[model samples]
Target: MMSDCGLDYIELLQQEVDRTSAKLLYLRNEEEPEEAPPPRHTPHTCSAPRRLAISPGLGGKPLTPPFTENLRRLLFGRTVRVFNFDWRKSFFHFREPNSELSYALQVDQGGARAVQMVIQARIIKHLLFSQQGGSEGRSLLSLTELGPPEQQGALAAALSDSLWLAGQEESATVTMVTEDDSPKPPSEYRLDLLTEKMHTFVFNRKEELSSFLLDHIHCFQEEGGHGVVLFLYSLVCSRTIDRIREDLDSSTAHLLQRRLGNFVCSQALLNLLLTGRATPHVCNGTQAPGGGAAPLDPPLQGVLSRGDIGYLHWSREQMDRDRLLQVGSMLKTPRFPVWLCCINSTYSVLFSLTRSLLSDWRTEHQFQLFYYNGQNSQNSTARLTIDTHSHHWEAPSVDPGVDLEKRFPSLEMTIRTKWEGASINWGGIPPFY
Candidate 1:
């Protein structure tokens, strides 16, 4: 009954609605798949960003300029392998590009002194002087063979100290080996005279010690020599001072006492022991060939005015170049008993490790002193470690001597074959265990 146009319009509208519904269903089907899984938390199984670091690599910040420059000079162009000690983990971590050239040098935080001294003195000396006189100079020179006996003696002393610091005491040996293939002359290094007990005088009270030395002041003087300095060194090493008194004779001691000066080597040595720095200069009644004492604004005490201390292994230019070394603090006094003593940077001396210098007087009474004769002589190779707490030379039951081979054979061989005069090892392979 409806009109033809009206009925057709209604039908068209219905068709359009049906078509639109079909197109929407097709589009929905194309957009999403039925097999897709739902999203989940699962935080434990997933990876997250790492904590940001202050430095580029896992290793912490870079070494300071002074340390870097030192490494650079010591290793030259060699690749530097860094070994960081993680106190937290109680282990060492190493880093490098290639395992082969990565670590040619090893530097620890606390033990840099040993490496530093060796590089500055031994390696540097060989590099600069080994080629002299057109003969390939031996890298290792005995104390006896070197000239300027005083200078050689000092260097030998430093080497000996380094050995002890490395804990190579009993492992080290003195042999008849020479730089050249020449006949092994009588072994300069001897160990027979060593005794178990060191004749050391321990004074808990400084004033008492001062009084005693002052009373026997004449026993320290020498003709044209710094006998007081030597005496103090001997005392620190726990050498038999009574024997020295005997050797000098009573008449000489009396004459020396009468001729003693207000400022003597003893005072300088005492200052070194007390303050860890020698203030007075030792005067031998002789003027320098060229000039007077270096004009220090603050002024220093003692006899010799010029800087009497010089490292034969270190040139003035080299010393000035290294800023960290320029300051005398590097050689500052360590805690008591553990002394980093130097004889004008010419010789090295060390006190006992068995007792700390700061130990309570009530608990422990003595310490040990170690002395290495680095002079270029048959006896230059000998090392004397004395138990300073005991005043007696011969303790009947005590074992005074420590056999390096028996105690630390591996360490001794390593030192002899590897580290004796070799350059610093960056690989951290030098048995610091």
Candidate 2:
């Protein structure tokens, strides 16, 4: 009986394995073959050979010294600002190579203010080989496609390597303002220290640091205060992910995802600065987003809806501010509250100003606002109060009458004539007295 029972158990185990294998085979057969990717199109076919030469304005005379120094600093510097530009139609147009390229670099030399440097260069080599891809051509080096982990790793490796290279470059006799009293560390040491601090900062405070960095990014731009505000506004003005997802359109969702991903990555870089390991600086060529390269997924693809996006923005803003306050309070620094309040006031003023401008535009165009309580006759008697004061006035016909001021008004004229035809059932309502 014991031998028979053991044999039966072995048989059952064999049967289960066979069943699973058959199911796996059936699923594999049912799967459709992946379609072959379309052939990659070459945008520019011109094979003209261009000499390797730095632009005149990149650094006054002798391209070798300043060019190498600045490039090294950009790649390995402790505090670096990651810029994202639209580059729709400018000399630095990523789509097409022009005669010249222009960019502005700013470095905070451990002083009260930042040092501004402008560099205009010509593109000599559009492509380079990377360890991951042999002879693979790329328009720009993008951290977004790399994903967060790989991007951070690559940046760390690059900074380490660049610092070593910077040390090898011949030193110049020309002297500028040296802020550090101690002899400047070899380029490699400085780079290592900067990168180490950044890693520490990012590891500690992920999202909060990113948001704070984005808020103060304007101070790093070369276009000065005027363009910085506009630039930042454009960066944050894209439609939310939820709205894009609700549309159920693949292309649009991809576009939004790409943009959102880029914004998130840019913010992540800013978060790296709060570690106080190094002062922040900006690099010229690295200024543009997607910098002539197409996103693997466009901004609109796989994006969240408008409501969700708004919530995310609000949540991030609140959390970041709260974290800053907590950290500042712990440090017992008086400057923290003042700085936080100032930034809050600036954002509030900007939002109000923009809203007013948009409202004026809507008024000129005869646009209107429509509201609804989303209640039926069964719930009509329920006391409801709508706040119109917070909303912008668009259509003159829709007025907030004195009756609405009462605690329990007989009628609430919240819906406009436009919405009445679509969202409301006017036939059921009593005729106006």
Candidate 3:
């Protein structure tokens, strides 16, 4: 037994030496250029170096050196923590209390790549949220309008790229073509242009946007655009898309959503923002037969009590036609009342499941409301309970026991005023019930 133990200890020591040697060699390698680029189909390696090449300003202009330094200082200035949600997996949490935001970065393999992805995500969040007076006054409108037109485009592109990174999908920035397909230059899918079009479509002509979305829904399912689609979904939830009507045909919309829901689990991201947990749904990728694409394990499949806590655009007409898109009509009611609100289409806000907001009305009661300033300049909240409280909606009202108003004053007012005096109860009772 002693001899066996001795042999095991020696083996362990040798392994440690090997690990240290490999790390030192890696550090040395960074100083040298590779003689040849990696072959196509190499996954995480391609995006990292390419993404670093991105300019921090709009329209490919690099920000001043101090700009990034300021962002880093703002993002990581206060306390930060990281923890594992699931023991068996390699997901990590990147959080800062000062920002009140958490990000989920998934790692399927043990290496430096996972850490790189997390750091990438951190920079993206800083660029998106912290740049615009933190989460309270956070607005894509600000991102778009705060700087020069050129800078706006750059900022939008950064957001698009950041969302792609967080999704952990293949790198769109680094293109590698196989014989089966032709190369798609990264310029083809300019997120800044796409974002501009989305804004024009959703905010200008609502009907045209829906039709346009239906026609182009297939693009979202493709690997590279999935992140963009997710970004749009969150944008819509922000209530940026106005005049969502039921007469509009959304079969294509439903199909696209189903595919996206199955393809990626966004709850991990939603949770990180709402509750500061970095737990996202992940599954081992299993390549399909005949070398087809592999699918991500549906993260929300096993969990009960359904709630989505991101920006949601709950169109009454759309929901009336198709209940599948409706949160309240889901087959299973979450243990806590769902807190959903639209924060305009320009940005997204995080929500948590809380029952304290629910009030007694009937066994089952639900209603929704919408608000827009005839343009895209409005935010609204969707209460998912049957409470018939005759409370008038007003701005500057704080959520009881919550400092949401303080965190995001502009957002609170935007949502609060939209629901003013428009209470609807389903119990056939009067407003005074």
User: In terms of TM-score, which candidate is strongest?
Assistant: 3
Model 2, range 280-399, lDDT digits (tens) per residue?
111111122233436653332111111000000112244335432121111111111101111211110000101121224342232222111111222221212223233322333344
- The TM-scores of all predictions, comma-separated, are 0.18, 0.17, 0.24
Q: Over 4 Å off in model 2, which ranges?
A: 1-84, 87-337, 340-433
Q: Rate the local accuracy (lDDT) of all candidates.
A: 0.25, 0.21, 0.27
lDDT tens string, model 3, 288-347? 222232454222221122322222333333323543122222212222332233332222
Model 1 stretches astray by more than 4 angstroms: 1-56, 59-333, 341-349, 356-367, 371-433
- How much is the lDDT of residue 42 in candidate 1? 17
lDDT of 1 at 241: 26
lDDT of 2 at 13: 67
Per-residue C-alpha lDDT of model 1 across residues 212-285, encoded as one tens digit per residue: 33333222211111122223223323212232232221112211110111111233332232232333332222
Residue 183's C-alpha lDDT in candidate 3?
Answer: 26
Evaluated with lDDT, which candidate comes out highest? 3
Model 2, total clashes: 24
User: Residue 12 CA error for candidate 1 (Å)?
Assistant: 88
